[model samples]
Target: MTYHRITSIDDRYFKPFHQLLQTIFPPEEVLEYELWREPIQDPAIYVYAALDGEEVVGATEYRYYKELRVAMTDFTIIGKASMGIGRFLMRNREQHLEQIMKDSGTVSLGMFAEIYDPYRAGIHSFGGVSPMNPIVRREVLSHMGYKRLELTYVHPSWDHEGAAVSELDLCFLPQNEELSELPALLIVSFLTGYYEALPNKPEAWHAMIEQLKTKETVKLAPL
Candidate 1:
């Protein structure tokens, strides 16, 4: 198996990438081709694909927020059950993130993952079929030294009244040469603060962040 960073969403890769995603996630969860294609065009988004020969097996998508010094990782999907594909993709993605940060003059890069809480019932739940369970994904992330910091919710659509809030677990992995400069707690605080300032319904984000701040962060095991 080989891994590659996809700079462009060409048909050569997207066709298989879409297929792999469809195979893993349900129809409701899958983003339309145009929707997925548009974001990848942004220079800030990093897309990586794992290939077994010419066939795509797994992929990961992450967006770097320069102001926040955070790499917001969206999804890490492994097409089929395998021992190390997920880890390989994650490690490679991290390396790519480091390179991007170095180029962008970003130090103390923080890796963040917004995990949809599978246990949460109702419209807020992130229910979908996948080759690996969400709990397993959390285990892998934990093994990689990411800490669960807070629980929050995001409106998946623009509709405020009817839209269902998606329950999210905000996880962070601090990668910095000066560990004292950017602690895990501080990183989480910065992210929540950033969200709280969003123009759309800033009050709601502030409320969520405030609630999250009151909750104790989950202790992480040593890597």
Candidate 2:
């Protein structure tokens, strides 16, 4: 399999990569094609594809907030399961993000991702098909060293049209082992940068940050 950092929306693999996301993720979670095109044009956003010959087997997307010294994993999907494709893609993406931080003369804090809470939202399905079981998904992520943050996570709607997603868990993986507990300020900074970049701010945005401010640190638990 060949790994590629897809830089342009016009790339032949872009459409297929996005199609994979549509097939796996629910419509509410997947951004509109044009909306994605805008972010892909930005320097902070990174999109990658894992291909077997000409077919896209896996894909991942991320956004690096330079000022906050942190990044967010926006989307990741493996078209062919249990082939180690997801691990390979994530490994490559992390290395790339690290390089970006190094080149900018800054240290990375951590990476965060919003995952569905199986207990609250049962199994996530699209068109009657469950692409990845939520329970098993957490196990896979746990194996990769990601931990669930001990806080109520509400996924903000960037478009302002969709309702805020509360049935999700915010998982995090720090840059190094020395960074044990997640600082509340870091989470606040990351969220601030995240919401600022988007056009529409979720109504709960301010309250969420305030909620984090009340705590000294956010505890991380095994996924």
Candidate 3:
């Protein structure tokens, strides 16, 4: 199998990625995004796509957040893919990251991931799914312990054809609640499965990021 990693959404192959996401979600619901990246000695985020021929058969996204520096995370996947690819990429990147955290005495893989099974109805993967990512599902927030978290929802507005073209900032605050991290919400939203959004559903994802944060408290020495 041939695997491709995307650092910039503007890459020629990224067109396929956009097509996949746009096809899955209505124009309004889907995010019109750009893949802007900066050069880093050790890359933190990677979007992997595998192709049998020239078509994208499987894909997954991963990241290494500042807070959870030790462990690398891969959660979101599109098309027919599995945990193995995700795990492979993460494990490969973890070697360097884990060592850094160990030297700093902040061991224990600090991966922020919710279990998922991709074969399920929607957005489920690996083990399970995160219910209603920040902007993905709004009504299900309070039930899952997530506060309104300030202005975080973007309402997708459709064009005359109703095919969905652009999005407008819709202030969706459940109630008076404190805001979480500032800029990290977008990055955190990725880990929360915000990309797999569907309209008019109870919950595309049954799982939600609740009690856990770090991949591990202390990194155990490699055997």
Best TM-score goes to which candidate?
A: 2
Query: Distance from true position, residue 98, model 2, in Å?
Result: 3.1
Order the candidates by lDDT, highest first — what do you get? 2, 1, 3
Show model 3 residue runs off by greater than 4 Å. 25-30, 35-42, 70-74, 81-108, 114-223
Q: Which ten residues in a row have the lowest lDDT in candidate 2?
A: 122-131
Tens digits of lDDT, candidate 3, 1-223: 4577767766666778657655544344334564233421125556666655677644555554444332333333434444354344434445645565656666442343322112222441221222212233233322433332222223213222223221222122211233333233333444344333323222212222221132122111101
Task: Report residue 88 deviation for candidate 2 (angstroms).
Answer: 1.8
Candidate 2 residues lying further than 4 Å off, grouped into runs, are: 126-131, 158-162
lDDT of 2 by residue, 1-223 (tens): 7888787778899899878778877666777776766767777777888999899988888987778877899877778766788778878987888789888888877789887778897657633323366776667777777888898777666445636778778888777855567889988877777766555655675677789999999988877
lDDT of 3 at 168: 20
lDDT (0 to 1) per candidate: 0.62, 0.77, 0.38
User: How much does each candidate deviate from the true structure in C-alpha RMSD?
Assistant: 5.3, 2.4, 13.1
Q: Per-residue error at 164 for model 3, in Å? A: 19
- The top-ranked prediction according to lDDT is 2
User: Alpha carbon lDDT of residue 90, candidate 1?
Assistant: 75
User: Scored by Cα lDDT, where does model 2 land?
Assistant: 0.77
Candidate scoring better on lDDT of 2 and 3: 2
